[model samples]
Target: MHRITALAAATITLAFGLGTGAATATATATDDAARVAPAAFSCSPGNFCMYSDWNGGGTRCQWPDERKANTADNCSFIQRGENVRSVWNATGHRVQYYTGTNYNSRVGSTPSGQGGNLQGSYQIRSFKPQ
Candidate 1:
């Protein structure tokens, strides 16, 4: 009788442990899905916009059909040293961005009317038409 009771208790504990692990994994997956959901696009036409969060979820800075040798000059978020995790090029031409001021250290570019999430690992300090 004692051996049977011990086995039953162990089995219940193992079942509960497995159930809890599955629940935790489900919650983690839900959280990841929420984080990756697409954010609203708010950039205006004929403008170039940069966001500090993935999928354009955080602070934004925009420029109208113009080259910016130093984005932090007038952009509050850039000035605060936030990374540019997304960009929307609503202008009429492809826009190339850089990791340093004065268009140094070229990173990438986006075509007109196209934009999406970036690697979120670097800041865009300058940008101009490609």
Candidate 2:
């Protein structure tokens, strides 16, 4: 009777461990509403352009009239999954400038010209530091 009971207990214990082994595994994070804009966007930051709109200094990356075109000449940008501390790896882009409109019209024209340049101060949006 004792031998039979010991063997039965050991079998039950092994079965329990095998049955719930996956429970100890960690759960992964899932964001259903997340945006898939990684590796960068189509917004360009034209090289060697004027930025008189801010009444600021020269050598600005804002370009003449570039609003949104993938201009990776002088600078580059990167997107991240979430925001976090630790600047070990790049989490976001150090945008020389941003554009909400297409720069097709600004072609072959100066930035200070009529509708050829970007006007007003743009609100800089913050992203997670990857």
Candidate 3:
């Protein structure tokens, strides 16, 4: 009876240890995926571009129309639960970005011929000429 109990306890302990190890491994993988950097984006002249991931990677939305009232329903990035992490304004004029649809709640602006990464506060739901 003593041996049986000891064997049962050992089995339980080993199973618990393995489960914890697997959980840790899965968490590590998720962290690594989030930290992965996206590839560089190429923007053409006279257009504005937004990236779904940092450094101009992931899904891209470009516009030559100069104004977008709604991006949530049309943009692939928003569909994927991702926000604009970087931007490139190749247009001649500076671009104004807003947090809400239809250009409400102005957040920031990006200069023409320049681009940079965002800190995740401004998701860029709408944008237009400055």
Ranking by TM-score: 1, 3, 2
TM-score (all chains, Cα) for each model: 0.68, 0.21, 0.65
The TM-score measured for candidate 2 stands at: 0.21
Best by TM-score: 1
Error of 1 at 110 (Å): 0.2
The digit string of per-residue lDDT tens for model 1 on 54-111 reads: 7777888888846999998988888887888888777777899999999999999987
lDDT of 2 by residue, 1-130 (tens): 9999999999998898678744422111012111121111111222222332223222233333223354333322212211111111111222233332223222232211111233333321221111
Clashes of each: 0, 9, 0
Best by lDDT: 1
Deviation in angstroms for 83 in model 2? 7.6
Scored by CA lDDT, what does every candidate get? 0.79, 0.28, 0.74
Worst 10 residues of 2 by lDDT: 82-91
Candidate 3 per-residue lDDT, tens place, 1-130, comes to 9999999999999898787974654454344212222226567667788888777877788877689998776778776667789887777778999988999999899766666688765578889999
In model 1, how large is the Cα lDDT of residue 106? Answer: 97
Q: TM-score for model 1?
A: 0.68
